[model samples]
Target: MDGTKALYYGAVALVILIGISVVLSVISAIIGLATAVISGIVTLAVLVGIGYVAYKAGSWLLGDDDSASLDSIGTGSSSTSVDAGSSRQDRLRKQYVEGQISEAEFERRIGDELETEEIDDIDRELERER
Candidate 1:
């Protein structure tokens, strides 16, 4: 009777071990499949991005005779020069209005900007044009 009981227990343990191994194998396979699918999607996105850049480059190089497009290709800055001091002053004014900066700090920054040479040159140029 003891021998039969031992055999039954051993068989149950073996069955449990086999079940656990099967479950683990299935989980590992699912993870592998998911990783492969995600990798494929990421690779496809990168290829599409590269293809778009190449297409744009080829179009720019081989497709146009238009002067307007060529003029815009590498020249991105505004034709008219802007006064950095005035822009900074405007930003400071906005910040003061928004209560982001103190009045004294805003006033000091505006004073500093007024003393800059670029602003002086811009003012002179404007006066000359006028």
Candidate 2:
């Protein structure tokens, strides 16, 4: 079964087991020690069974692949790296379009293509202008 169904059934079983334990505890108090021991064993077994099912379901939801570990999945090994420089270029282009910089200033800053030097020059000029 799916993880959700497994978890739902497991939780329901746990609740039923707890209710039975409580009822048995009350009965044992009225009767004797044997009922209490039996209830305790049943409760322990049910809890262990639930725990094992939950663990298996969790493992199934998370892929079985070794690379599915959180650290490994998020590491640079999986997919494309974001171009940090592109964000800066995008910001500069937006500012230029928003009339934050003069045409000459924008052209001079964004000249030819997006290079580190151009971004640095724009930053320096913007700082000086401010």
Candidate 3:
């Protein structure tokens, strides 16, 4: 599924298609069939060699993680954790919203509970500011 494997597979498929096309073309040719077959075979062999080289190059560029976990992480399957300070802040906010604490007191206490971890851009911390 990664670029390396994709390139390798694509090269292989291209070689196969080209080989088939050359064979068919040779069979339909009006000239010497033997010469055509030889030419076709040589072309096919060269294509296969090129495909192998391309496959090796791709593997060198992309590394050897067949699972491609790094690629998948960006697609929303990764897990994230909230630090203790943030969790405490969430609890405080809930209590403040429910009238368990005054607005002024909530502001002071929440402000004192400094965040200990980096905030992700997707996490709307400004909502907590309100």
Estimate the TM-score of every prediction.
0.47, 0.27, 0.27
Write model 1 residue lDDT over 8-119, tens digit each, in one string.
9999999999999999999999999999999999999999999989987887889654555644653222222335556777898999999998989988987887777466
Q: Which is better, 1 or 3, measured by lDDT?
A: 1
TM-score of 1: 0.47
Clashes of each: 0, 0, 0
**Regions more than 4 Å wrong, model 2:** 1-31, 65-130
What lDDT tens digits, residue by residue, belong to model 2 across residues 61-121? 8865444664464543322222445565677789889999888887776664466646655
Give residue 76's error in model 1 in angstroms.
Answer: 18
lDDT of 3 at 35: 76
Which predicted model would earn the best TM-score?
1
> Following a full C-alpha superposition, what root-mean-square deviation does model 2 have from the true structure?
22.5
Q: What is the RMSD, in Å, between candidate 3 and the native fold over all Cα? A: 23.3
Q: Please provide, for model 3 over 1-130, each residue's C-alpha lDDT reduced to its tens digit, 9 standing for 90 to 100.
A: 7999999999999999999999988876746777788999999999999998999788778875444654454423223334455678999999999999999999988767653333443454553345
- Models ranked on lDDT: 1, 3, 2
Model 2 vs. true fold: TM = 0.27
